[model samples]
Target chain A: MEKEIKHLKYFKVECFKGLESVELNDIAQFNIVLGDNNVGKTSVLEALLFDEHPFTLLRRFYSMMSFKGLSSNEAKDYYNSLEFFFSNEKDDKVITYTVSYNQLQKNEFQFSIVDTNGMTEENIDNLKNNTLVDLSQLPNTIVLIKLNGMTNFYTTDINLYRQKKSAEISYQPFIKSGLSYDNDLVQFFSSTVNNDLKLRKEFISNLHFLSDEIAEITIDSTTVPNNPILMVLFNNNKRPIPLFMMGNGTIRMVRLILEIMMCKDNRLMIDEIDDGLHFSKMKKAWGIVLEVAKKYNTQLFITTHNSECLKMFKEVLEDERFEKIQKDVMVYNLFKNSENKVLNVDYSFKEFENAIENNIEIRG
Target chain B: MPIKIQLFVEGKSDKKFISDYLDHLGLNDVEIIPLKGKGEVKNIPAPRLEKNQLQGVKNGVIIDADKDKEESLKELKKYANFNLFDEIFFFPNDRDPGALEVVLENCMSSTKKQDFEHCWFQYESCLDNFPQGFRGPFAKSKVYAYLESVSPVLHSKFQGIDKVDFKDSSNWDLNVSYLDPLKMFLTKL
Candidate 1:
């Protein structure tokens, strides 16, 4: 049988975050990354988002730093946050993330920090004395992005942090843990599924595992004028309740399903996919995810620390309903080697099934 | 400090047998893992050994020689090429070409051996009267018959071969020479 082609066939990361060096080959459509905490499961997801235009790359870089509670509107603080993105083991201060869409095409992005020693003593003293220094008048630290035989540089300016630009390249939605349900959900729903009845039906049917009472979902701007809140109409004909009022698991599942629905023919990366979900819901959750991913041809990359989640993944893949795409799954186990370098061990579908069935420890 | 040791066996029967033997040797810190079958001995240990590599666990495997010692060893070495196992020992003293049943047969008492031989001769004669020959595994059949002869009530009450306590003196002599290689392997571990 011929193998199914995936959007990302290979990936490699050198000097990014806590990962010293790591490479993942033969990437599958549905990949699960397992490792100990701080072993760089989230780093791999961050690297996948690196293959973007320079503007979007800068936005993503800031977004990642903000995720770590390092957000700042000042130019100096933004420059300080760049120190946390590189690996501590290397002294040269260069980071590279590479990805291959197919065997013949490869894209590599290299990032390096440039020092600005041209600031005069008087200018530095003025910046220190002032509450908000004008970025146009000061020498700033610049980040150079080189990709596809092109180079672009962005300075640590307030405007770079304030500009919100959508990605011009392929869209890959990354759903992290504790994601807030905000206007993005409203815009995504209203633009994509609101006018299409088939998609809305599919979304509601997939969410039935969370609760059958979720009869319909909509964005209500009248409840809080100018603030559109996602509301759910239950089957009991009661008043619509805001999505934030629902349980954490329900909100997480809703967000996940929405992304999966919007992520057709693209890739989606989810961290700690079983974060707020109960063990009993894993099987149905996996079933819905696999069905939607297969239907839309969207590749999936998910991470989990729960063994029950792995077990349910194996069970759902082995299910007779998913026999066709059973061979499209892979599990990557990451662990630090004897030399303290991060390494990954890939397991094919059969090998993963064997390990799970025989009670072997592959989660590291 | 003593090194932590982990031993992998083929099935529940092998696990029970080795667990008792290790206990007899007074080595209790060793962990015995029973895999699904012989094929899994090649498939299951790489990831686990890598996971525990930092802990400095001495990993090893105890498997049956089956029909050929060299063939089994060659196949295992191919799969276990990760340099994980500290040692790999085959059953029936590692040099022989048989399974746990061979060791059990060797441990039978000399006095009962004569009685069992006579019963075996009579059983073979009874089977010869039927033109179709007996087609079961010879060593396993002999071990089961020997267990039944030792105590039919105990044999009937136990569910499987793995549940039979090898600690009973009447079942087998644990001090036999056929088990010295396994004992030495455990001792070294």
Candidate 2:
């Protein structure tokens, strides 16, 4: 089944991390969110992933916390920090989010703690009652989790519903800076390419922007179809290197480029688009980014702390070739204030250029 | 992003001084952007001021009322909408066309200003070997001479005045009488 949803034009999230009832609007095809550290930039991406089963994403969230060097107990406490995800209401039993494709269609989901103290029949019943969208037909998901502090125990459950009809959405891809380190890229690339030789070629060619030394990138077909390893052939070295040994910048860029190419008419969310690439390659990389995004009509939501990235992105997106379609690219600065409320400062392309010229510290 | 106001200044010194003054006036969230010179202000990026982009952020530009006040204002008007700002000030409050240095000289103690004048007159009286109308800018030369008279080390060691903070209210005995217009405008902002 496919989704009719192509562009996630808007999002409103409440009671998720530090973002308290934050609303992001006028979302362009290619969006850049700029802000200081710990200002809810990542939370925005997490909110978009609300359609995914929360239990499946628990490891993703747990890894996000544990990688920061939290101990076992600290990681558990952090995971159970309902107050962190709780919106400002005195008793925030529910956290809700919605990602809209347009005026008529959207995916909305919510998680409520009917048994934060302990998992009860009432708790499971609450999730069943509050299932906002028909999951199977509407491309929606809901996860219910409970933590019992007295016994230091926790339980997570995932539910998939039978929808009356299945809705068709193009595709939606989400990437964080840590994707490569999570050992998920190899299988991701393998399955994304599937058995299509053309997709395999397209993926490899895009990665050539990172290094011309690679002759080609191919998946090992002899391995299991669902979990195939990637191999790269360099021009000078006859010995082809497996993609598993690929380092930071290479894997990150590969995943990003492949997703953009394969997703076609989908939406792509990248947490930090400027990571691992050299400062010198910023302009060229952005040029490629603009070319492909415009070509495939992929809506992008990318975040960055580097002003140069923003500047280069503007330079490429407004080039004569793409200038006619420049309205699709927008820059926004997200800020979280003391009350945990989030606000965004929207910058038109012209304003973004002026802000860069004026050296305004938009990121800070 | 909630920057209540933004001040575009001529260069580093103006940026530093005005930033401190804004702090002193308790408009701490305001941003002061240092520009290369008067030319950039005249160009001013030219974005529509009435647009939503700058709706809440009041924008102001401070330029030297250099040589031709009318010409300076005219060029600025080409880019900025004067009505959009709460206040926009020119340096040297009572000026026959001058820059930031002239404004700082106005901030000096009255007795020091007189001494600076006396020193300038002494130097002028001895310049009999120069051509007619050969004198340099009085405002700039006088301020440098004042610094020299007060402390020879400051005159010799100071590479330039662009980074000095003349608007630091606590340490600077700025002639508030001379500063009234700028001070009033800043306080309102």
Candidate 3:
């Protein structure tokens, strides 16, 4: 199997947010993060951005900080610009992070927060578009540099983000959304499903879990084929309804399906992975997720506060097919120390199920 | 986190009896997990707590020492696995010339015990050739008969057979010599 891009084998963060010196060892292909509220489950996902510049990471981090909605324009305030760092103030604040190839077999570069010396509207525009903007060129913008890759997202000009979006790469992210506008998600969703048979088939099969009446998925007649607005066709209805007309559970499922099918050699991170699905269908949803994710070789990281979700995931992974790759799946239960920082406990598959069956309250 | 203990008992009756005994001994943080039946306990693995969760969490099972103690112990041993169960105890003390009801019978007052014997003799005399080799110790039937002789009306209140107090409320007490080993062993855990 030829991996198109280097996968993250291990990660460690020091002096970043409430997470101080957090380290995850032997990370799996399919990983899950569980903890109580505000334990930084989403923050940890944001930290694993794998971006070339800090600004893109910053934009993502800021959007995430606002809980998936741009409820605030703190990104525009220079005084609060650096508040994203630990302690919400950046006076000589520097966050150091390291990524390694599988157990740190090969060391990855160090990216630091540097002074913003130069400022230009175009540079900011390019960063927003996830295009290559040289950190060296923008001596003014917060940037990340790879020690061995030689060129940063700014220099080598590789907008893997944009390239992924265009090439249907899976690095799709479903950050928190609280009645917020998501231009990228909205844009990607509307344009990608037109005349896509494979996508429709996958959507139909996955949608059946939510409603047996869903017979078809297609673009709304109001929208032309070229500029498609996706819709769902129920078995009993003569006319199809716009996909958004359905509940959040339907939307979450379709979004997840699209990401799984589109991403190859990429990854996905979802917050509250089990928000709307019933507990009975949770195991089925995971089966589809595992099937499609593996079909595309997509690495997945999701966070859940639901125990039934974890229990079902363990049920699906119990198949002998997942036995060898069971090592590729990991479960982490996050806890807060007395100092009010996050820490985690990793359980092997067997032990995890054991804990759940015994009702030990691992989630809290 | 403080240590947690899980007990896989045969059924609710075993749980009720053992829990009451544990309560009398002043133990805390012990959870009774009823497997619903002895067969389930035999089929299911003992709850092996993770050492990483804390330093001293422990788990085990409590089951009946049904007639034929040797065979019962043999089957119970099948549920035992290394590192899964730190302890295993048979009801009415590890010794099994009797069951939990035997312990209940022992805890009765001297006068009640004599009356219980008389009721047992009368009930046996009324039987036309009881089941072959039925020497004695029909624990359950004898207790019910003795209670009925004590009060036919209050016998109607014998809701849970496992919780029947052989003596009136003021004289209630478990026979320590009959219960000490199991109690001491549990408290130590």
Best by TM-score: 1
Per candidate, native contacts kept equal: 0.30, 0.12, 0.00
lDDT of 3 by residue, A17-55 (tens): 667656767677788877788887877876666443444
Candidate 3 whole-model C-alpha lDDT, 0 to 1: 0.61
Q: What does candidate 1's lDDT look like per residue over A1-364, in tens digits?
A: 0134447888888899888777888888999999988889989887776644565666777778777888788867876787888989898677887778885777877777756476578745543454232345435466656575345343455565446543222233788876756567777777677778998898888778667988999888887898888889999968889998887777888888888767777678999999888899889888878887787778889999999999999998888998778789878898876576788888888878878887777786
Error of 1 at B165 (Å): 7.5
Q: Rank the candidates by lDDT, best first.
A: 1, 2, 3
lDDT of 2 by residue, A1-364 (tens): 1234477777787777667676777788878878779888877776655444444334434434443454244423543653455655637556666667675665565565443445466744454455443332211222343222111112332112211121122123567665663335555554556456776776667667678788877666565565567778899988777776877666666777777775577677788888877777788878777667766677788888887787787777667876876677677677654454566667777667666766655775
Worst 10 residues of 3 chain A by lDDT: A155-164
Clashes of 1: 0
Could you tell me the TM-score of candidate 2? 0.70
For model 3 chain B, the run of ten residues with the poorest summed lDDT? B46-55
Which residue pairs come into collision in candidate 1?
none
* Cα DockQ of the candidate 1 complex: 0.34
List TM-scores for all candidates, in order.
Answer: 0.77, 0.70, 0.67
Alpha-carbon error at A48 in model 2, in Å?
2.3
Summing lDDT over every window of 10 consecutive residues in candidate 2 chain A, give the lowest-scoring window.
A158-167
